[model samples]
Target chain A: GDSVTQTEGLVTLTEGLPVMLNCTYQTIYSNPFLFWYVQHLNESPRLLLKSFTDNKRTEHQGFHATLHKSSSSFHLQKSSAQLSDSALYYCAENAYKVIFGKGTHLHVLP
Target chain B: NAGVIQTPRHKVTGKGQEATLWCEPISGHSAVFWYRQTIVQGLEFLTYFRNQAPIDDSGMPKERFSAQMPNQSHSTLKIQSTQPQDSAVYLCASSLDGDSNERLFFGHGTKLSVL
Candidate 1:
């Protein structure tokens, strides 16, 4: 069985503050593929970024994440948080099937 | 591309009634998956089909839930004797294939409300 862990509970920060959403996973596969999906209000989840190669940073929109196989972590980061970035973020491990983490609700306040 | 299409954006059913949700995957996708979303459980995988064949249904409830993919174009998920706790958004997604490298394309889910 595969599992994904993310930052628990709601994360609130000022609009201009740095954004960091922690994620870690456990899987049997040596080369694991991980993904970040974002779901806005009343919208379905959409893929923000995905990575397979270890230690390689994958960027999409204004966010970036690097898969660290040694640590089994893929933390999403951005230079600054935007009000529009407030949403539910999910970290998923794509083994045989996609296993999602309990999402983190990010609230960017102005 | 049309991504994925789910019918009846919303559904309302009595506690003891039955509900059937429909999903139309992308035109050429070989993999179709169903999931239930709720505040408490988050995204829960229900079942999936590959090439019009059932691949993994371990997440489905044995007695009340059933899924079918008679053809490559569409799939259906039927829940019999639905309960109040069965209320949640039902999401359907499709991918080029069922492989790990393929990213899923999700549709606007069907919000099921059981009274």
Candidate 2:
């Protein structure tokens, strides 16, 4: 079975500092699609970024993630954390089905 | 568009009772997906329908769970003999197709509690 692993269960960063959420996955399918979804409090989870091509950086709403098949990782990163960036982040891998990580709660302090 | 619409934002059922959740996808969308969310398990895919036909139900638990897309506009997920373990938020989403890169439009989800 395919699975996604998100190492950080919680992340806290001061505003203006860089932030990263680690995501890794295991699957036998080639051309796997990776996705980042953000769930704000009381809101539905929405797509933030998705990548199907290896080594290509996908950016959305000032956040970016690059898929690296060599490392089986697609880490979400932002140059500077914003107060509004605090949310639950989910990393997913899509093959014939979609596999999601447990998610990481991000908190940005002003 | 109104995005995805799921009815009965919240539901409560007695143990062993039946529960049915409904979802209306974005118009013209060809793919519909159902997922379960919980504090411990996070998000889990349950089933999906492409063009009103079920494509994959591998994630669905046998015996108690069933899903149907009678038409292109809506789908239903029914659980018979609900249990405490079945208490979770059920989310429904729609996409343009079954393509891996297609962006999914998600409904707010229906939170179900079984006592």
Candidate 3:
């Protein structure tokens, strides 16, 4: 079985501050594909980025994540937070099934 | 593309009643997925179909729940004897491919509330 873990239930940060959302996963396969999906208020979850190649930095919409198979972690990072960045972030492992994390609620304030 | 379309944006059912949710996947997508979203459980996979066939339904409850994909165009999730705890947003998504790296297009979802 595969699973995903998101440590931050909620993360609060001021605009322009650095932000990081922790995401880790476990799988039996070495080349497991992981994804980051963002869901805004009253909207469906949409893919933000995905990566399977370990150690490669995948970036999209000012956010970046490096899949570290050595640690089984793919931490989402952004140099500066924006007001629109406030949303529920989900980390998912695409194995036999799509195992999604509990999600992290990020609130960016001015 | 209309993306994925879920009928009855909201559904209200009495406890012990039945509820059926409908989902129309993208025109050509072969993979369709159903998930239940709630604050307590987050996103929970219910079942999925590929090429109009039941692929993986291990996530579905043994009793009182069933899913059918009679054709490639539409799928239905039926819950019988619904309970209060069954209240959650039912989401349907479609992907060109089911692999982890493929992009999944999701519907607005049907918010189900059991009275």
**What would the per-residue lDDT of candidate 2 be over residues B3-112, giving only the tens digit for each residue?**
99998899999999999999999999999999999878889999999999999999899899999999999999999999999999999999987788787889999999
Q: Whose DockQ is higher: candidate 2's or candidate 3's?
A: 2
Off by over 4 Å in 1: none
Q: In candidate 3, how many Å is residue B98 off?
A: 1.8
- In the range A1-110, model 3's lDDT, one tens digit per residue, is 78899865789999999989999999997778889999999999999999989899999999999999999999999999999999999988886768788888999999
Deviation from native of the Cα of residue A106 in model 1, angstroms? 0.9
Clashing pairs in 2: none
Give the per-residue lDDT of model 1 (tens digit) for A5-109.
999779999999999999999999898789999999999999999999999999999999999999999999999999999999999999899888888999999
Tell me model 3's lDDT, rounded to 2 decimals: 0.91
Better of 2 and 3 by TM-score: 3
lDDT of 3 at A61: 99
Q: Any runs in candidate 3 off by more than 4 Å, and if so which?
A: none
Q: In candidate 1 chain B, what residue range of length 10 has the lowest lDDT sum?
A: B37-46
User: Number of the top candidate by DockQ?
Assistant: 2
